[model samples]
Target: MNVVCIGSGYVGSVTGTAFAVLGHPTTVIDIDPSKIDLLNAGKSPIYEPGLDQLVRKYIGKTLFATTSYQPVHEADVVFIGVGTPSKQDGTADLTYIKKAAELIGAYLHPHRFTVVVNKSTVPVGTADLVTAIIEEASGLKAGEHFSVVSNPEFLREGYALEDVFFPDRIVVGSNHERAKNIMRELYHRLVERVSYEEISKDFAFPYNPLTPKAVYFETDVKSAEMIKYASNAFLAVKISYINEVARLCETLGANVLDVARGMGLDSRIGGKFLQVSSGWSGSCFPKDTAEFLQTSRKYGTELSIVKAAIESNRKMHEFVVEKIRRRLKILNGKKIGILGLTFKPNTDDARQTQASVIIQMLLDLGANIRVHDPKGMEMFKAVHPHLHVQYCASAEDVAHQADGIVLLTHWNEYLQLDWKQMLSIMKTPYLLDTRNFLPKKLLIGLGYQYEGLGIGTEQEIDGGIMNQFSVLSV
Candidate 1:
């Protein structure tokens, strides 16, 4: 099958590459010539664990990246994997998705049947909107020559390639039987190939002797799209709920780790995203939660709990900043060292990262900042160059000439650092572990004043400092 993927970004690149690896002739289109050139040269524009090898294997053979749209007319199936960024009103901005549809339609040859899949995360009813735009642009009626399907992606940054190859479920949202069959065929290779050895080789780990084979679920188009939104929104809510509990744990002298462990053991309440941290921030969670809230509102239903979750997550970051402000008394002239900048570890994606927000807030308060990230420094420098911040080679370099330290992102390197030695170089031995990735006892024993999201001494917990005084109905 000839497949064309619009927007060779995180989603497009990964999804397109997956299809190409499955023996389909795939071409990824993007307006960014440099990104196209990089992919053509077997250099992945993004940092994914197994993407470079995947690109290298299939770049010229079955997968091709280009800035041209001519392939849109040539392909049997076209996947629109562009970004639908959040607007100020919290609604998804569908400009990019619409443009991709428009381009696909305008260049498409008439009388040729094509399946248009919404590979990007879009609001409900967007598939209809895409169909309308394409119909208008191509001068073709829907279902006659082309059909639209809402096939949203559910990929994680660090584990995108693996997720695609071994998806838990494959949702193909289309009312057209032909379109659905086309999608099924496209993903049939994944369904047929059941190889535990391949999975173990991919992770470079021994096979779990007790683990079961992977399973894939197939569902209708609407349900599939809803699954993507609901899944992300629920995870966002889970993270926010844990953070809120962590705040109370800080006052009650209850360790959040223990609380999470107890809560996780309950079969109904599985432990995932239950770790108490500053908040959930990345490209997906924040935007998807907001979009889900807006989508609920549009459907005449108020998802008050989800809305609160979004607000709570935002406040968590501010709470961390406040902790710094309270301890330092004033941020002016204070040289603060930030341990990490990316939204998460393993991948250098800073989109909507809590650290970015916190750093901006600190800088606004007249704090001179020194930042170090394992892999996100290059990306961060591009977004925040005007700020009075120095990018350092190592965490130790960032600690030098710093009055205090903030562990924003829990990178592996940050977790492995000699905290005592790093603290000794700082002007002040103060550490704010927003992510709760550090050991509280070790830091305090080392003579450093340590603070975490929801951790403190027994006196601090019993003093009602961290407890939420007003209890709400659960």
Candidate 2:
């Protein structure tokens, strides 16, 4: 299958690259010539594990990238994998999607039956909107010449390749049977793969260990769009719920880790997004939740729990700042080191990251800030150039001469940091584990004042390291 993906952003690049890896002739198109040049030079525009290597391997083989839509007429399938960024009013900004649709329409073959897939996360009826736009621009009827399919992507940032290759499920939502069949044929290799035991006997499916094959779910177009938003909204709620539990644990002197462990063991509540933190802020969760709420409002419906979850997440970041304010008593002229800048670890995305929000709050309180991240420094600096922050080379560099340290993103590298060395460099060895990722007893034993989210108890439990938090319900 010849696949042409429009808008070579995160989704476009990953999706196009994956299609090319599957032996399809894939061309990724973007408006930015620089992004296309980077892709053509065997480099990925965004930071994703295994993306650069894949791009390098397939650049001249099966993968191509361009800034023009001239190849659309030759494509069997054109995927609009553009970014549908959220507007300030909390609605999805569909400018990019609309433009891609118009361009696809302009270059679409007049007689060929091309399947246009909407890989971008969009609101309901967007496929219909794209269909209408394409029809208007191409002067060809949608059902006769081309059809639109709502195939929402569920790729995670850090593990996009893994998610694409071994997805839990592949959803294709369309009314046109021909279009659906085309999509099925396009993804046949992934869905209908040979037995893993025959290929790599020792290899394991790390994501879905028990599942042998990824499920294929076919649904209506509108429902497919809702699935993406609902999925992220539910995860956001779980995160916010855990943070609320952490707050209760703080008040009741309980351990949230134990609580989560006990709850996760239940077959009904198998854990995935239950990690307690300073709220959920990322490209997907925050924007999707906001859009979901906005859609509900437009439909004259209310999602009270979702509203509360959003509020709780906002307050959670403020809670981290409050902990520092309470410990130091004076924010002005106080030097603090912040660990982690990205919203999540293992990816260099800094859009709507919690670290930025917390840093801004700290700055507002007149605290001197120094930040460090393994991969997010360049992106963080690029995103937040207006703020005056000391971008350090390493975690210890950020900690040096600081009065306090706050662990924001739960990056694995932070786990291996020399805590005692960090203590030696800091003016005051006060640590706030906002993600509750560190060992409480180990830090306390090192003569450093350690505070973890929802950890109020000072003593160890069951002869093990002390851990604490448990439940928030609507």
Q: Against the true structure, whose lDDT is highest?
A: 2
Q: Quote the positional error of residue 340 for candidate 1 in Å.
A: 1.1
Ten consecutive residues with minimal summed lDDT in candidate 2? 465-474
Best by TM-score: 2
Model 2: per-residue Cα lDDT over 1-474, one tens digit each: 899999887899999998887788999999999999999999999999778888988898999998989999999999999988889989999999999999999999997899999999999989999999999999999888999998999989898877887888998999999998998899998787634333222222344435567889999999998899888888888999988898889889998877887888988987677778887997888889999999999998977778888999999988889989999999999999999999998799987789888999999999999999999899889878877899999788878889999999988777778877888888998998887777666677777898888767573433222232111000
lDDT of 1 at 384: 66
In model 2, pairs of residues that clash are 255-468, 255-469, 256-468, 256-469
Worst ten-residue run, lDDT, model 1?
465-474
Against the reference, the lDDT scores of all candidates come to: 0.82, 0.86
TM-score of 2: 0.94
RMSD of model 2 against the true structure: 4.6
Candidate 2 stretches with Cα past 4 Å from truth are 194-211, 457-474
Model 1 CA deviation exceeding 4 Å by range: 194-220, 458-474
